[model samples]
Structure formats: structure tokens, C-alpha cells
Target: MTRRDYYEILGISRSATPEEIKKTYRQLALKYHPDRNPGDKEAEAHFKEAAEAYEVLRDPNKKRIYDQYGHEGLHGAGFEGFNNFDDIFSSFSDIFGEMFGFSPGRRSGRRRPSKGADLRYDATITLEDAAAGTELDLDIPRTETCEGCTGTGAEPGSSPERCSACGGKGQVYRSQGFFTISTTCPQCRGTGQYISNPCTTCKGSGKIVREKRLKVKIPPGVDTGATMRLTGEGEAGELGGPPGDLYVLIQVRPHDTFVRQGDNLYVEIPISFVQAALGTTIKVPSLNGEVDLEIKPGTQPNQVYTIKDQGIKHLRGGGKGALTVGIRVQIPTKLTREQEQLLRSFAETVKDTVKGSGKQKRNFFKGF
Candidate 1:
């Protein structure tokens, strides 16, 4: 029987890249795999067809010849389609591993140990702590190796025995028409070992959920959204596998008196109108502590003053940011009659001086 075009079979164009071709083949193979669609002859045939196309297109030399002379040319070069399921699986073990996460040939034995899942913990800190760095003890919840079974899941005096269903192998093979397919052994769950007497503590799971207290030191300049990774601090692995990592996500609490932008801090300090016009030294809040700031004469409302090295530390490099203080001039809401009269007299004198100069400043508080 004449075969379909390789590109057409894989549902790809002739100009498809190698990665695109492999991706297409992987999808098709996974969709029509016999293990997934048991007792379906049409799906098995599609799986074989995809495997054959992938086999030729994955090899550079075979692809070059097939591109030049087509399937007829591939036949002339001694290219034969897969003879059986084993042939197809053996030829595409790597691709199958990418699809099923393990080599297909190893299905007949114990599955390889896989790393445990990584975990995440959210950590909150004050803005001051973020600026100066702090040490904290965190209570983390995770899975740890069981003490009763020592990670084996078997009782103290009893050990796991070989699975009888798969004859100590991890997988069981079944004959379906012209194909022999292997699947994970249900009795042992692919471990090839069965616990006769389950561990009382972990109940044959090999892991226990417990809370662990860990001391963590947060470096200075760590901002919100920064992450710290602690290796080997996640869930315990299975079957002698390595433990995963723990990620701590930082969340900096909002400051009551300051706002941070990158490494800079902004603050608004209220000063009396008399102090603003006459200049004075006042204390302002900073991440470090209270610091004295000098207000120059003629300091206007909303005017800004900067204090160097008083803000948040740089997260990446050296030096710190500046603390910008915005001036807010306070206007007295209540005054005695005598005080009001005195202010009115002062305003009249200032108006006369401006009139004598024959000049007026724009928006110079004419009402005041």
C-alpha cells in the first residue's frame, strides 16, 4: 500500500523547523498511544504512523534524502517502517521519555526516583526591617522522611517484598492484537516492592507532614517581591530521591510615615508658618532614627529638602538613597482678637511697601 507524505502524516508543513516537527509528533503520539486508548485498533495504527514519520524526520541524513526523493527514495536507502511496538518504542525512547517522563524500555523494571516537589512560603516584614535587614525564625510546613520506617514505608521488623503481580518488575505487559504494550504495575504502583506491614507512623507513605522551624536572615535592601531559595528544605523525596527547594517570597509591609520608591523615601513634615518663614532646625523620622533637618529662611509650602544616605539601601549595588522631605506650612485656624489685629496691621504694612515700590508679585496672598 502507498504511504502518506511524511509532512502530511505529522500535520506539518514542509518548512517546519526540527522543534516544530518534534512537537507535532509528540502530540500525535501521546493522543494515539495504545496504553491511553486501549482496544482501539485505529488509534494504534495512527500511533505507528506518527512514529514512522518521526523516525525519518528526526534523523538529519534521512530527512535530507527523504526531502530530495520522498518515501520512494527512503525505500531505496533501506529505510523500513517499524516492524513491531517494541521496535517503535526502542527507536523513539528519548521522545517517549519526553512524552511520558520516563524511558519506555524501563517500564519493565522499577521506575527511576524523581525529585520531591518544591514549596513556597510567604514572608512579611516591616519596611524598616527591609531597609536594615533582619533575622527571623520561620515555621514551615512540609513533608519529611518518616522516622518509623526510615523512608522505606515498611514496618520496623518487616521489609517490603517483591510484587507478585509483575514478578518483581514495575510494569505488566499485555498483548493487544499485534502489539505488546507495557503499563505500570497496579499492585506496587511501579515501585516493584510491596509493603507487607505498613509503617504505623506514616501509614506506608514514606513521608510525614510536620512543621519545621527555620532561621532565615534577610539581607538589607530586599524589597517586596524578592525571593530567597533554601535548598533541601522542601518535601522529602521518594525512593532515595533528592529533596526539593523552598522559596520564600517577601512582602514588605507599608510604612506608616514613609513611602518608598525604588531606593528613595518620601515624607511630608508639617511646620508652623512662623518656623517656615524664619528658618529653624527640626527633627524628622528616617529609617535609621530621628534626624535633625535645617529649614532655610523663605522655605515655601510644598518645598522639598533631601537628606543623603537616609533612605533605603541599594538592592543591587553600593550606597543608599536620599530621604526627600516635603514642607507643609500650617496655617492657624483659631486666633485671639489681638493676634488677628496684629496680623492685619502687618499685612497693611507689607501692602504699603509693595505699593511704594510700584511692583506686585503674582499670587502674593493679597487677601492675607
Candidate 2:
């Protein structure tokens, strides 16, 4: 049988970190899981290949041997690839535990108190606000535990009854050929209990939807797609569990004059060709204010200069980054008659000077 390089199989470089390998494998598994692909043979093959690569690379010893000696090293140590889909499933019985809900393995013989779902809020702010940092009130709509029955889904006086189908285990286990599959109990919907007398406020769901005003602090230098987590601000947890978090997705509006890279700000300052020949000082725009920048004599176009402490503040409390200014020497698009005549005279003078010096002619305009 032929085998592909494990790194290539997983679409990762050989220098990929362990966390990177795991994250990539999780993505590939979700995309090619047998359940998701149904009857696609190619998808199943890819799924198996990714799983095999992950299994070897995750183990330090196996990876070391495989890196030193190719696939033959594993075969020499009595390790062959999975024989079939059943073999792969048997090896990783609860592989989808953290991924899909198929084999959640989330239940713990009793109702588990899992954290509530995390919420996301998209916020658009001005670039100035991102550079200097600002605070904003975000209205987050989420679920809160019903106060009437204290999240029991029962009326004030009455309580829920244990589910008879699952015997309060919250799941039903059944044999599927060589595998035992666990699914949510249909009678209780994984809640482990049935509410005979439902709460009037939450309507037997044990939670109520409400909008909350949360004040979130936006840190300085936060770029677009930056996610800030507000702890314990998500939906109320199930049963007696802790609440999840709220992630704020920040999007900074584009600046009119500056482009930012990391903490550095880039701005192009257009100067006349005369200034390029004889250097001059100009006021450059920065996040703070206008700063004087000195241009050197015979400065080339697109020459970059750095203005210290004029960029965005550090996300964490540190000094500001630099503002980089690129010089753009603008040539005259249309020349006046006198200006054209003067330029032609200058060129002729330089050509005559070169010939008189008994030197070979060279392109002198390149210096400008």
C-alpha cells in the first residue's frame, strides 16, 4: 500500500506546532466526517487520512521515528494504518465528543451542568477610537434563567418528574452492531426530567429572553476582527451551571489618510520634484497631531522615514508605535513653455559637459 507524507496529508508544514496540527485536524475532521458526507467515498477516505496523520503526529515518539525514517518506521514497529472505517471508529470511539453532537459524551450519568452558549456582537467604530481606546454600551440579547422557579422549569410550588424512558440519565444507549450509540432521550430532550407543571414565565424552557445593556471597554490598537471577551455575560447556563462569555467583534472604519500595519501607521506624503532635489521639512499627519519631518537632500521617491511615538498606542499599556512616512516625488504632468525650455537647456548642458569630459554618455535622469 502507498502512503502520503503525514504533514502533506494533513495540509500542514513540517514545522507546524502541536496546537496548529490539532486545530487543522479538527477542521478537516468536521469537513469530511462520515456522518456529514453520508455516502461520499472520497470524503471518507480524506477523513481517514487526516485521522491517521493526526494520530501519529500527536505522539512524540511516533513522530520522532516517522520523521527520522519514513512510513517504514511505523511498519517496523508493528503499526499499520487502520484496516477499515470500523477500525478507525473503534480506536477513536468518542472522536466527535468535542466537535459534533453525534457522540457528545457530554452526559455524566446525571444531568451535567454545562456552560451556556457564548454570544457574539459586531461593533463598528472609528479609526480614531481604535487608536485612542474608547468605551461603548452594547445591547446584548440573551437568555436569562427564569426567576419564578429558579430554572427548574416548574411552577413555584411544584417540581419536575424524573424521565422514565432514560431513568434520569438524560441519554438512551443502544447497540449498533459492534458499537454502542448514545443519543438524547426523546421523552426529556436530554434534560433528564419532564415538567408536568411548567413555569408560566419561561414556558417550560427554564429561561427567558431579554436585552441587556453591557458596558464594554475597547482597548487601544484593536484592529478589525479583534475579539474582546466579556466574561460571564452570555446566556444563563443550564440547570445550575455557570454562564458563558460574550465576544465583541470590533471593526475599525478605514482611515482617510493612513494605512495601519500592526502598530505602525503608513502615510504617503506627496512632494514636488524640486523638494526631492533640495530637501525640505514638511508637516506629516499622525494619530496624535501634525509632526515636522525633515527630508534629506536628493531624497528618492518612495523613500520611507519613521516618526517615533506618533502611531497607535499599544493594546496593552505600552508606548505608541512609529508612524512611517513614504515620500512621493510628483513630476509635472503638463509642463509650461518656459519650464519645458529651462529643463531642455539643463539636459543639453549636462550632455555637453559629458562630451567635453571625454567620457561615455550615461543616463543622468535616473538619479532623479
The lDDT per prediction is: 0.87, 0.84
Error of 2 at 22 (Å): 22
**lDDT of each residue in 1-368, candidate 1, tens digit only:** 98999999999999999999999998998899877787899999999999999999988999999999999999999999899877887688777644553334434546666688899999999999999999889998999999999988999999999899987778777665544566779999989899999999999998999999998899999999999999999999878799899999999999999999889999999999989999999999997789999999999999999999999899888999999999999999997989877776777787644333333554455657
TM-score of 1: 0.71
Per-residue lDDT tens digits of candidate 2, residues 315-351? 8778988999999999999989899777767767876
Model 2 TM? 0.61
Model 1 misplaced regions, further than 4 Å = 1-11, 14-109, 352-368
**Where does the lowest 10-residue lDDT sum fall in candidate 1?**
354-363
lDDT of 2 at 320: 89
